[model samples]
Target: MELNSIKDAFDRVAKKQKLSCSKSQEVIDQIIQEIEKALGKIQPSLSDYKHVLSDLRTTLKDIAPLSQLEGTQKELNIALSKYAKVIEKSFNPDIAKAYRNIEFDVHTVNQIIAIHFYRQGFFDIGDCFISEARELESAASIKSSFLEMFQILEAMKHWNLEPALNWAANNSDKLKQNGSDLVLRLHSMQFLEILKKGSRNEALKYARNHLTPFSSDHMAELQKLMACLLFTGRLDSSPYSALISPTNWEKLAEELSKQFCNILGYSFESPLSVTIAAGVQGLPPLLKFMNVMAGKKQEWQTMKQLPVPVELDKEFQFHSVFVCPVSKEQSTDDNPPMLMPCGHVLCKQSIMKMSKNSTKSFKCPYCPSDVEATKCRQLYL
Candidate 1:
């Protein structure tokens, strides 16, 4: 809703700006036309066109657009000021106070951001940042991996699959273990490219050489590809024509990015990007909570954890977490989650407290079964 308000405000400002510009232009054109008319009536041999010049000057003075133009310009300025106020009200600038007590390692942060730039193919900016920040070693170490990824992506952008094919071929076994069909997908693209170029025989040969290996796993898809051969020079009109949709190339590029990142033990998105996305998702709730805490005169900075949960999407979830139902505390390394014999999990500290330091057995908090704390096993996420 706030976004819509901001957009509407911008639209109003833009409309007023356009109106002001058009009015100003109209005024200038009118003045120029009057001047031209007065010039056209002038006689070079006689200085007797004073009446015509006077009429042109009177016409210019009587022009009424200047007032309207000034009004529009004032409206535009007022609209812009209102838009800035909307932004200021929607975003709480005091939110940064939530992190005022936290200490940051500037050097480490600079290196991480610099490496993120390098990984995204901004080599010049990354290099300049690294040189300025004295993080040459850290940037140099991961440069080759990102460089190779960019080269393959660049080739894919131009519809050249050779580099990607070679990379997939080299990592064939690992790719298969990871359940990636990237090699077959690339081969399918190559086959389609060949078919599109009116080379039925070459497409057949390419399919035989490249697509045959995936026959057992992808029989239905292979059959569809084979059916394209029957159409030969008219694949676009064939039943399997949907395979030639432009979106397939886009999906292939996404798949290749995922596979490449998986092979390199890196996230598909840059770490810095992921961090920023998560922070953006979590910031609103945090700011609201902080405001509430301030109103109540509570000590939010000293709190061990947030009083409310800041829910994020699945993409930002990097690992599983367990919070003890009995103690209302999150599981941590010092108090790792443990599974009881009754099939319920609780933090080690909570179990120990319920069992009175494990001296006796206690009933499960959510079940009637009796269980001993010593018998509980630690659970790993």
Candidate 2:
């Protein structure tokens, strides 16, 4: 909502600026036109035309565009001031305090961020950062790997698949282990390209050498591809036309990126990107909480944990977390999750409390199993 308000304010300022410019231009044009008319009326050979010059000046002074231009400039200034205030109010001056006393190693952070830029193909920026930070060795190791991946992706954008095909084939075993059908997908795209270009025979041959191997597991999709051959160059009008959607290329590129990252044992997203995204999602609540606790200086300063939970999407959830039903507390190293014989999980603290400091067996909170806390196994995520 705040974003919308800011956008509206920006739009108003832009509109006012354009109006002011148009009115100013109109005023200048009118004055020039009146002076030209006055000059045309005066004799070219005559050095005297004082009355004509006076009339031109009077006409210029009476022009409505001059007053309109002034009003527009005033409106433009008002719009600009309003936008400035909106921007100022939108920023929370105390937001920086949320990172109070947190220590960061500048060199290490620069190296990580620089590597992230390199991985995203911002080589010049990354190089500059590395040079300034003098952390060449740190970013040098993974640079070539990301550069190669980018090269392959760049080729994929132009519908070339040979580089990706060879890479996938060389890493065939790893792809298989990871259950990635990247090679098959790449081959399918190649086959579709052949079919699109009116080469039915080539498409069939390509599919036979490629898609046939995956028939056992991908029989349905294989059948669809085979049916697409009937349409040949007219696949756009075929029942399987959805297969030829331009978005398929985008989806394939995304899938290829995921497969590439998986093969390298790295996350599909850059760590820096993920960190920034998570921060963007979590910062608002933290800022609001800080504003609410502004009066409690000592309490906020000494607080080690957030008073409220910051919810993030499942995509950002990188690990399993167990919250104890009894205590309504999250499991940590000091209070690890425990699995009872009844298959119910609870934090160690909750189990300890329920078992009365291991003095006796306790019934499961949601079940009838009476188990000893000592016998409960620690569960790791």
Say which candidate scores most in TM-score. Answer: 2
Residue ranges of candidate 2 with Cα displaced over 4 Å: 44-48, 64-68, 93-95, 103-115, 123-141, 194-202, 228-246, 291-302, 319-332, 335-381
For residues 276-379, write the lDDT of model 1, one tens digit per residue: 99988888888887776776434776666667788999999989978899888878878999999989999999989989999999999898999999999999
**Model 2 score (lDDT):** 0.85
lDDT of 2 by residue, 1-381 (tens): 889999999999999999888878878888788878987878773566987888877787788665667788999999999999999887666667565565799887886698688778898888888888888887776677778889998998888889888988999999899988888888998899899899999999999888899999999989999999889999989898888687998898888888887776677888898998998888888888877777876787675656778899898999987778888877788889999989999999888888999999999989898989889999988
What Cα-based lDDT does every candidate model obtain? 0.85, 0.85
Residue ranges of candidate 1 with Cα displaced over 4 Å:
4-83, 100-111, 292-303, 338-341, 348-365, 368-377
- Let me know the TM-score candidate 1 reaches against the reference structure: 0.74
lDDT of 1: 0.85
**Model 2, 269: alpha-carbon shift in Å?**
1.0
